[model samples]
Target: MTGRFITLEGGDGAGKTTQAALLTDWLEASGRTVVRTREPGGTDLGQRIREMVLHERGHVAPRAEALLYAADRAHHVETVVRPALERGEVVLQDRYIDSSVAYQGVARGLGADRIRSVSEWAADGLAPDLTVLLDLDVTVGRARVAAARGDTFDRLESEAAAFHETVRGAFLDAAAAEPARFLVVDASAPAEDVQRAVRTAVGALVGIPAPDPSAS
Candidate 1:
């Protein structure tokens, strides 16, 4: 009995990390084994690759950046995500192929299909059973990120507002294209409200009841 795969995605400051933590705790309290991890840093190799892609001293070409991400995805899936799922543990991932498609493909003008193909090949066609998309205005998302990490802009975070706007559109388009696999939530809401929505959506996948406020 293989376990389910759940992914959380959104632009920066969409509260994915917070929601992921909450969801993991809920699943664990429900007696399900959960493996919570994130992309570009899930493994030792991935951590090195992450630094190169997001914090290297010099510029990396758009295609090079995409391939680097693909490399990390390949290793991460084989080493961390797949083994956990094969052991029948729920795999809760933060960011995945969707991030590459939006950031590299649509935002960088590198072609979404092309980026998708590379990522699919890297992960050997693995995909999440459900992707929770936290949607919010680009400006609000950026402001949240800035406040959280003052004077520290990552490679992707430092991009112009217009670039993030394009990335946000790409995320919405992806969600629209695959309604069955995606649960889009308005991230402008308060954190607790957003976590409630996330719990409701993920509970269905794991055959658990809706979150109990008292338990939380």
Candidate 2:
């Protein structure tokens, strides 16, 4: 039997990565082999693509940037993610296709259908079993991102709250369309509360009992 794929997603500063780590550790303690990875960095090629997507190297056209993200995701799935999943190892991803759909497709003014087509080609149709979306007010998200020590602002970071409204709406739309696969998390709460929600969501997805310890 193949393992389940669970992904964390949201606008910048939604704390998806931090939540992903907590979930990974919790799931690992349950004796399930867990593989934690992220888009645009899971494979060597993907890492290069990540730099390109983040505009760390050169200026990338918006459409080209979207395609590059798709390309990196393709390699990531084919090389690192799927194999572990086939071995029944729980796969925890920091971000997934919806990030592109929201950031590029909606916020960048590209159509979601076009983005989906490109992404589907890239991922070979391997969608995650569950997606956790950390929802927060755009202003709040930007503020949190700015306060983080290791966080690097991306191209999408400069956009004002209005742009983020589109992205957030897109995320909510995706979640509404696939209620069984997407969980909207209110990220404005304390960090531990958000992590608790993630743990519960993941536990429900894989039929594994979550650790009962109170969030620290």
Candidate 3:
């Protein structure tokens, strides 16, 4: 049986990492083999590319940035994601094509369709079975990131508030366009509340019975 693919997407500090870890832990507790990974760093080559795109102190052209992301996604999906899924393990990824579509396409003015085409071709059309989108106000998200990382910002994180707002809008647009594949959750809630919502959403996908609050 082919395993399910789940991707977590959101702006910086929207709690994607926390949610991914929580989901992975819950899924493992349920006896499912889970392959947790992230794009732009999922593979050896991708790690270098991730550094270039995210932390390198230089101006990379918008198109070049898009292509670098596509390259990483291509290698990551081919080597890491596909093989794990083929082995019947759930592949939980931190980011996927939607990140590129929003970050490069809308925020960087690279055109969403163009970036999507490049990313689709690179990943060989491997779309996630489910995408959990953590929606939060850009200002709130930025504040969270700032509070967590004192005076440190990656390339994408350092962008102006307007840039992040565009990225947030793009994510919501994508979710709205594909309601079946996306579960949009308000991320401003407390971490415990977000985790509960995540568990409930993912429980349906893996056929896990909902938690019995009274039993616990």
Candidate 4:
């Protein structure tokens, strides 16, 4: 069997990057071939798309932005993600279709069905066997991101509070829709606590023993 694909989704500063790295380290130590990557990045084309989507000061129409993301996703899946999974490696990603479903579809008011259809086409039938959602309050999450960035902001950082709330709500709704496929962790918890919860959840879902705590 191919190794499992696990994608982590969350709002800004919800610790998706930190947690994904932690999990990757633990999984590797436990003897799994892990292919770690992030969407809107990973591949060169994807990185370019990422820059346009996040760093560009120029406003893009919501539908156009959605298409850019879908295009980037298509290239990423075909060139990097698929091959890794086929080689029996567990592919861990920081973001995936869920981001689009929330950002462009819900928060940007682009229509969920249309976004889903485009993303489904881009994904080419690949879906995460399991998804880990790091749920943090919008206010707290924004603060964390702001703190890390030394008071600087990206294009997304300039978005209104209402937009962030919509994104968070969309993610929670997506989690609710796929209860069996998701594990939602309270991201406001301490890092060690977050690691513990993730370790427990992953072990349970994959039928694998938890990594040695000390190693983790």
Candidate 5:
């Protein structure tokens, strides 16, 4: 039996990690095997790449950054995601091809088509069965990120406001283009509300009731 692939995407501080954890907990409670993972740092090698792309203090050329992300994705899918799916498990992932398209392709001035093409080739064209887009205003997102990070922004997070706005638009455009694969949630809502929406959407995929919020 094939498994489900689900991804969470949004600007920084969109509460993806929290929602992913809640979903994983509820799914496991429901008797399903779940593989919770993320791009950039999902594997050992990916951790190193994540450091370079996100934490390193130097400017990486936009194309180089995109290629690094694609490299991590290629290895992540082949080694981690594919094996989990082949085992008939739910792969709950944080970020995927769309992040590359938005951050590197559109926001960085590279063509989205070009970056998406490269990313698709890297992952052998594996697409998520469901992609939850946590839509949030860039300004609000940045403020949340700053509060959580104590003003310590990562390389991408340190980008100008206009860059983040571009990234937000790109994500929305992508969701609009592929509504069948996307569930857009207003992330500005309370955290529990957003998670409830995510669980409702994901439960429909796995044939489970959205677990009670108090239980989660």
Candidate 6:
């Protein structure tokens, strides 16, 4: 069986981790082997890169940050993602190129096209078969992050409200541009609702039946 690549994209506190776990559970129950991973930490090198890019206290130049992400992507795709997919497993990723394009490209004023090009090159033109974009209000996302993390925030999460709004808009624009590859869902809804929407989209793509809504 050929493998499938599916990615979850959204702002922080958008319940991506939660949804990923739920999706993994559903896929496993259906007798599919799944490889659950996330960008910038999917591999050993990626873990170090994740720390430097996300948790570093000092400032990192815009271009430098983008390159760092690309480097991580290159290594991650070459190592973790590709190998899992080759084994005919579902590679359910938490975030991918869209996160870079949204955060470093538009929000950082580095130009979306350039960032995307760099990312494409880094990942060797690998794109997810389905990218589930969990759309949420920026303000609400920030509030959720605050409640979860308290006063501590990562470099990206520490960004201003306006930055996050720009990121959200960029994600929407990208989804609009590639409607077929994206399944946009309202993430402000309950977690179960979002999971159901995700499962429906993913099931259709993978030729599996989505759980009956009435069952939940």
Give the winner by lDDT: 5
TM-score leader: 6
- What is each predicted model's overall lDDT from 0 to 1? 0.93, 0.84, 0.91, 0.88, 0.93, 0.92
Q: lDDT tens string, model 1, 1-216? A: 398999999999999999998888889989999999999899999999999998976899999999999999999999999999899999999999999999999999999999999999999999999999999899999999889988698899999999999999999999999999999999999888888888888899889999777544
lDDT of 6 by residue, 1-216 (tens): 278999999998888998999999999999899999998899889899989998989999999999999999999999888898889899999999999999999999899999999999999999999999999998898889889889789999988889988999999999999999999999999999988899999999877898799654
Give each model a TM-score: 0.97, 0.92, 0.96, 0.95, 0.96, 0.98
What order do you get sorting by lDDT, best first? 5, 1, 6, 3, 4, 2
Of the two candidates 1 and 5, the one with more favorable lDDT, higher being better, is 5
Clashes of 4: 0
Q: What is the per-residue lDDT of model 2 for residues 92-183, given as tens digits with 9 covering 90 to 100?
A: 99888998899888888888989988998888988989999889888888888888844567766766788888888899899999999998
Residue-wise lDDT of candidate 3 within 90-147, one digit each (tens)?
9999999999999999899999999999999999999999999999998888889889
The alpha-carbon root-mean-square deviation between model 3 and the true structure, to one decimal in Å, is: 1.4
lDDT of 5 by residue, 32-133 (tens): 999999999999999999999999998799889999999999999999999999999999999999999999999998999999999999999899999999
Candidate 4 minimal-lDDT segment of 10 residues: 207-216
- Model 3 C-alpha lDDT versus the unseen true structure: 0.91
Q: What is the lDDT of residue 88 in candidate 6?
A: 89
TM-score between model 3 and native:
0.96
- List residue ranges in candidate 3 displaced over 4 A: 213-216
For 77-151, candidate 4 gives per-residue lDDT tens digits of 999999998898888999899989999999999898889999989989789988999999988988998789876
Q: Please list the residue runs of candidate 2 whose C-alpha ends up more than 4 Å from where it truly belongs after superposition.
A: 150-152, 210-216
Name every residue pair that clashes in candidate 4.
none
| Colliding residue pairs in candidate 2 | none
Error of 3 at 3 (Å): 0.8
